[model samples]
Target: MVLPGVYAPQEDTELLAGALSDEPLPPGAAVLDVGTGTGALALEAARRGGRVTAVDVSWRAVCAARLNATRAGLPLRVRRGNLFDPVRGESFDLILTNPPYVPAPDGTRPRGPARSWDAGHDGRLVLDRICREGPELLRPGGVLLVVQSALSDPDRTLGLLRTAGLKAAVIRRRRIDFGPVLRGREHWLRHRGLLSATDDKEELVVVRAELPV
Candidate 1:
């Protein structure tokens, strides 16, 4: 169960989960789920026989994920810290992240539930960091899977990953109606030219970047 203030699994989370199902995890593969809100994706990896560790910047999320993993009878190492911080000096066979990619007016990270989806105006605040740091944590032949909204420019993510020497591409995409946070800022987004007046549905994309085998 998701604790209050922890990000509950949503469409993006499910989309990532489905993609994870296609990944053939070798037995005992080390997996890391950055921004593991409820341990949803982490557990999925564990189910596939990967030894998983989940990292979140929110303490509440870490506690929630830890609790959920215990109840699920899966052993998940959940840690509270900023992206990649808790797992520094360690690498993994796979990294999964559904980071904040909703564009908000302020660039500053929120201190409340808003932190779940409120990314800076361009929504690249967290996405950019993940792209840059993700590869460094990958073992050779490792893969980094990240989901982002179309509004935040998935192409940029692809470019960044490729620039880092990974063979990267959009593995999956889905169109969904705007969530509450996006609905509330529709006008602002349109005004800022990030969205068109007629645009009601946003596209979510999963990018897979693989280090050369």
Candidate 2:
């Protein structure tokens, strides 16, 4: 169950889940789900025999994930901390994240429920961190899967991952209509030239980066 203030599983969550299902998981492979909200992805990994650990900065999210895991009868370790903080010194066979990528007008960091999607002006605040530090937390031949919006510039994500010595590319793309947040910010986005005047949909992409063995 999704707790109050915790992000609920949406299209981005399903997109990542689909990609995870296609990935061949070795028996008892170590998996890390960063920013795991309801633990949906973590549960999926556990169901596939992965030793899954999920992390989120929100206490509510951590509690929700733990409760969801217990209810699903899946083995999952849930922790509350910023990305990678709780999992330091632990490398993973696969890492998954669906971080906040919506560009916000304010440059300051977001708080409360907005933290789930109100990224900074360029929508790269959290994305950049994951691109930079996520590779270091990967085992040999480990894969990193990230879901983001087209408006956030997937090319930048690709370049950052490649620069970090990973083979990165967009593996999945889906066009979805704006949600409440984007709908409300449509005018501002258009004014900022991030969105077209007539466009009401945003393309979400799943970028897969893999480190060489």
Q: Each candidate's TM vs. the true structure?
A: 0.98, 0.99
Encode model 1's per-residue lDDT on 1-213: one tens digit a residue: 989898999999999998999998999999999999989999989988899999999989999999999899998899999999999999999999999999888778777888889888789999999989899999999999999999999999999999999999999999999888888989999999888878889999999999997
Candidate number with greatest lDDT: 2
All candidates' lDDT scores?
Answer: 0.92, 0.95
State model 2's lDDT: 0.95
Candidate 2 per-residue lDDT, tens place, 1-213, comes to 989999999999999999998899997999999999999999999999999999999999999999999999989999999999998999999999999999999979999999999889999999999999999999999999999999999999999999999999999999998999999989999999999878879999999999999
| Model 1 residue 114 distance off true place after TM-score fit, in angstroms | 1.2
User: Poorest 10 consecutive residues of model 2 by lDDT?
Assistant: 193-202
- Of the candidates shown, which would achieve the greatest TM-score relative to the real structure? 2
Model 2, 36: alpha-carbon shift in Å?
0.3
